[model samples]
Target: MNTTPGTRWDVIVVGAGAGGMSTAIFAARNGARVLVIDAAPEEGGALHLATGQLSAAGTRLQRSKGIEDTPESHLADIVRISKDTADRELVWLAVSNAAATIDWLLDDLAMPVLPEHPVRGQNHEHYSQDRYYWGPDLGRSILAAVRAPFRELIDSGAVTARFGTEVVGLVQDPEAQGGRVTGVVTADGEEHHGTNVVLATGGYNADPALFEKMNGVPAYADASYRFARGAGHRLGVDAGGYTRNHDLYLCSFGSVLEHDDFPAPVLCRPVHWPEMRMPWEIYVNVEGRRFVAEDEPSVDVREHALLRQTDLRRYIVFDGRMLREAPPMIPGWSADDVRAHAGRHPMFHVADDLRTLAASAGIDPDNLVATVEEYNANRDGEDPLGRRFRPLPLAEAPFYAIRVQGMSITSTAGLAVDAGLRVVRPDGTAVPGLYALGELLGSGAFMGNSFCGGMLATPAMTFGRLLGTGILSW
Candidate 1:
């Protein structure tokens, strides 16, 4: 059975992602009469593709593991990690409610986290507290955990979900302040009226043009959910709510692409984490000059260095001996597999000499040879970049180079919202019935110019819980 086209609802959620599902679930449980519409064929938006990491302080699991943590500590760590660039009000709101969100998943929903979860940090910078958490299956595990409860609400006729349907526009009441968004317009030319509209539509990373427009860089890697195409951004901005934090855009460290394109599929992710595997390779830009120290501990420092490079590209140079002697650069593949990929793939180049290798990999050959010479000269002495781990110099034949591109899979710019999550104007007046959450609020709103561990997924659900529980009213 379909919901009547013009029927009124207490809350109309635009995208059925983590945030949207949470809002619909809680609102329906609270007897709010919710409607969830998504462009995907089923629910679970970015969670289907995200890392599924969650960070919260002071959870029951933490206490059980003798981990003493608090929301204040979490907030302080985020502030410190993000360099005080994150939206303080929004970050505070998420951290304060994050523990409850995690508890609801663990205790109420029985979602299983890793046995040694609540780790200090993983790939990114370390948080002061052991608050980062994720499941065995990553994001999919969280998707499975939320699906059952949300489906129950749908089955009980409390919440209605319309999948594979896109929200084309927002219905605004011209007579109200800031043209109050009263409902949403679907692609089928139907208007679903509601008291409040929540724009949980993910981000614009999948849309290359939009991503570049917002981030000042091309979407180099095709690693985001395909349906996140800025529908919410359009709806919110059209409804008079402006987007913010575009200036806070930051790229990921680096990943090898399958092909040379504006937005290419990610072929493989090299393990650049020094803590996990010490680097036996040197990273250089297209100009064949070393930018950041290869042993740079901070992921943020390496990522920002890549951001400064032309086309956000880096070339990881090493030798055959390093492939066999050092830990596998990629998690699983071994020395033989690395040799197979070198000449076969465009991103990977192998040659007998540095000049020839640089030519194949599109790096400056003269600069490459000179850079290697300088690097090898400093092998027994102090390094120029202050690199601590200088195990071996690049003297072996069959030299290799892996070209990696730095890119962000999440949007940095998002629609502006006030304390209540209501989409607001520049003057600070709320668009009466409009609310925005999830990636539509942008990653920068929570993580700022840096990638704070689990900030995206955790805050998304926390905001949804906050919005659905006693925030929206008929």
Candidate 2:
């Protein structure tokens, strides 16, 4: 099922995701023959599952909304969120190009943001203005918009898309002077040569074993792109690029995964922590004790606390009152849906008593019972430790508990690159003809220490645009 047989090109992009497509488009449009290859049957990598939140400063959208922002402000926000651990120059590059790149995506690429969007902030945090936006299906909208342009390129023979093809290794011309990569070898032993190769393959979150090896934390997440096995990293390192940012592995909480597969579906979504879903429910750590404010205002605050816990596992304890009074906490689930899965949802372990519920949920029976009793007693504001956020207590129950684990959808650790998006070796020599975009460069590189706005999608697009139109030109 080769889309283009025996086709050589000026540039070969090793993915069909956002960054890969952007590179191919710009390269082809600039009179360079480009070949796009991907392991997926179609375009769009993690974009299909992404929330598509992006933050940009000094854009037309910001001006329209009467919001004051600049590239400096954007850089400040990214640095603050990353606690100054982010690379200053790289962050500047991504932030500076955000507005223009986004504009290009919306105009030429047909990207549309969410309707009530450009919100100051939503799931992540306040970005200082109404610049955040995503389409109805989030990442899917961005993917759809970009796909048509690439299709035109494919039809014109300027871009060759080879889907269901894996790059087993990179091809280097040692005798061709200065060790420049010539092309890549696909899994089926096909060598498609090109002048430049762009590695847009995503992160390694889907491969737990590899992720755990890179980052010290165990890969408890079940929500990353399956094909993001760090194939690009191996090829990059094999060709002399150095990997960095393996220290900043982060996780998200409030998910009740039923099993251990990567990218596992949420069996029960807890809206209690971020107050996105009200804290009509209380959370207990594996020790059967309340660890957080329950209804914390900042997602970072909650995520930080969850990271300290064992294996990122926690249980949600809610009473009949919350079940009846609060809005359906889980996104996409109605109260009726909760009722239908009353005894069936694996996380929805219910019992007549606190001890019984603890046993069913694999929690310490006595510790859980004491924790509940203590919480109930403190409902009157008698305690001083500042543990209860609502002080509503969990007394009125057909006591129910659900087990949840913290997981991630993108790679946080990656190779360290210069502001020019060049892959640098250990001795600090820039590897010519080698460039990395998207998750292969690592999520922490752009978004910093946290998911600051839409750093993942935005940086990939921004860099791809920068390289396609400028870097690869000379």
Candidate 3:
């Protein structure tokens, strides 16, 4: 493409996810001209599908509850969860600004939290204090608060938003003194130029090839925003940014996929946590044997164990008796719904006998039989291998199996950046005028190696606001 006349703006944010939109709002509000671009027709990227869990520390609620949590405690929790693998400085920055960020959302951004108010942790883990909350509709609620402000800025001509234009490449000002990025070239050969660019394009969870190359593991599922395709990541790399935290890539626990396309998991209703689904059901690997405690308290512990196992494919096997007696494992499902779910979904496989079920599902029949027998025999014992929840024996006939695969919607590995959110190269030099936030910066930065409640949505909102309003303030 020919070098077009470089257009100038104070900030150009790539991708219209929570991060990009949040940044655009702040940047525009801060008396700066901003343009937000996304490949999709709509602005909310993966927010449509996300559960929208957010975490913060030292909030109004926390203070009212008399809960003592410093930014250091928040950082400590993240580091401990990540086993000291995350960027400490960035973690500190995020945790330190968390309360102010949340306050901004609640007061100025029109964010509305649930009535429960400041629950420590309901869906994921417990924070040191009660400072976690989600909007009524989760992703939609946050988007509702953010979208209008962004659109208002665009309407007033302070912020320009161009959707359906995918950023294809980064344009560096070679003749410029600093290695500044002058513009971004779209797929359709249009160049949207700016003085500073924020890469809020989200992660590579949708691109298996890029994910495998960067993360060193096969992209388990195409579960994120398809447009997110790591456009920002590729652009960052092209502009000489170095990626890190690839080793920290982690997968969500037990998704029973419906088809090749991901986010397509038949049921992703957090079957493992809270030990909510009765443990009469045992998870078996391709070898047809139980490996770890089915009801382990930590999703991370179960996930790490699954990664160590062969194929990372497991079958949840439960007897008819338990199926009839226990509460529906899946939400909004009657027993008939559960029965139909087995045959209707691709991941779900069923059979009348253990032998036939194993053969049909491609698991070893003998091993499955042994596993079931061992589980049944030792279930009542003081201590049983692979038994943490004191689940009933799997002795009834007509056993059922649902195939669960490890998957992740957020990319954990991402471009390395400093506390300022500037894209940094491997040599530790800043990629001038380039910044990254949200999933494009990877979840590993905030959540660490663990999925600590609201790291995904919250940090994106926080960092995007901070970068646009705070760091980039001139």
**Which candidate has the top score in TM-score?**
1
lDDT of each: 0.90, 0.77, 0.77
TM-score, cand. 3 vs. native? 0.93
**Which scores higher on TM-score, 2 or 3?**
3
In candidate 2, what are the lDDT values of residues 1-474, reduced to their tens digit? Answer: 233566567778998888898888888888888888899888888887887777777777667767777889878877777777777777788888889977776666667876565777776756665667778778888888888888989998888888998988988876665578878899998787777788899888777787888877767656666688988888889888878887777777657777655446656555654545557677888889878877677787787788888778888887776677777777788766766665686667877788888888878889898888887777777543354456366877687777888777688888766777767788887666777888888877776567677888888888888888875333
Q: In candidate 3, what are the lDDT values of residues 318-370, reduced to their tens digit? A: 87887898777766667677678665666666778889888877789999999
Ranked by lDDT, the better of candidates 1 and 2 is 1
- TM per candidate comes to 0.98, 0.93, 0.93
Q: Write the per-residue lDDT of candidate 1 for residues 43-70, one digit (tens) a residue.
A: 9999998889899999999999999999
The candidates, ranked best first by TM-score, are 1, 3, 2
> Which segments of candidate 3 are over 4 A away from where they belong?
1-7, 260-265, 268-270, 343-345, 386-388, 472-474
How close is each model in CA RMSD to the real structure?
1.5, 2.5, 2.3
Q: List the lowest-lDDT window of 10 residues for candidate 3.
A: 261-270
**TM-score for model 1?**
0.98
